[model samples]
Target: MQRFQGSPRSVLSTLLLVLVMGLLLYPGLKNIAVYLFSAITGNYISGTHSVVFLSCPNEQVGKVIARTIVEKKLAACVSILPKVFSIYNWDSEITETTEVLMVLKTRTSKIHRLTEFISGSRVE
Candidate 1:
């Protein structure tokens, strides 16, 4: 094996190049960097957006709620996920049931209205 002949500056440059490549190639690191940049620049404001989760007894209920939310501009999007199994305690009893999960994405300012609408539109 020949003796290494690179200078300190060259070695550091190579190490930095590798680090930059890693940051570009790895998704997790890239996301962290982007998040930091956005945070520092005030481009990503916390509490500006909200994700609300609602459980529905069936797909029809989920669809109805989703549609109403979108139509009323309470949420920008509502994703209805079906066949979600839930086990929980209610009134001192364990209840197990399949439920539809609704994920609502909306502005934080609209969260209160969205929640009120959901409460008033409860299927039960």
Candidate 2:
């Protein structure tokens, strides 16, 4: 009975420690995740009223993604820049490529949902 009581107290202490660690890490982890997502996708959503910059492989994908976003009411407006040069590192290689730029205008609150929609759109 004494050994079992000690085990329960130790288990409770471990659980409390885990809880505290989780609470401490959660906000920072969230920020890091947002930063990484923005860095990787280039959807650099900033400010209260936000603009997200996304690059599509071509005019067609750009149009499709832009139009679909607007139609779904995720963005008030989306403008497609016909041709843009993008230079970035991928797969440990620096590559320069031509792509269409899609400018998305929406409130900051909509950014997460908009990102989710784009993620499922399969345009990449």
Candidate 3:
């Protein structure tokens, strides 16, 4: 039986060919390929997007905050999660409570305004 031998350069070329073929054949790999390409080329897909997380005392408060931010255009979208069990230290004591979580998606340029609005809406 004859054995086949390949040079390192040929092996690398074969591997690269396989990788390109795999990327082309698999649709799900498109995102990964784009990300790797971006990293290698230093050509990032740019957007000034930001995600902010806020915890509210209850669903009503969460809804109010969400509606206000969206209405004011401070956030493009707000996702409200109704039940989040949080444990934290307040006033040197441990506190446990069920809270609503708000995830706000907005432009980084509006983060300052969004923060100001949320802080001003806090209940004493």
TM-score of each candidate? Answer: 0.63, 0.59, 0.61
Q: Candidate 2, residues 1-124: lDDT per residue as tens digits?
A: 3555568789999999999999999988987788778769877556436889988899998888888899899999998997798899999999999988888988687999999988877865
> Model 2 — TM-score against the truth?
0.59
Model 2: residues with Cα > 4 Å off, grouped in runs? 1-47
- Sort by lDDT, best first: 1, 2, 3
Leading candidate by TM-score: 1
* Best-to-worst TM-score order: 1, 3, 2
Instruction: Give one digit per residue, the lDDT tens place, for model 1 in 1-124.
Output: 8987999999999999999998778987765676677658868566567899999999998888889889999998999999999999999999999999999998777988888888788654
Per-residue alpha-carbon lDDT of model 3 for 88-120, expressed as tens digits? 999999999999988999877699988888878
Q: In model 2, which residue pairs have backbone atoms overlapping below 3 Å?
A: none
Off by over 4 Å in 3: 1-44, 122-124
Task: Output the TM-score of candidate 1.
Answer: 0.63
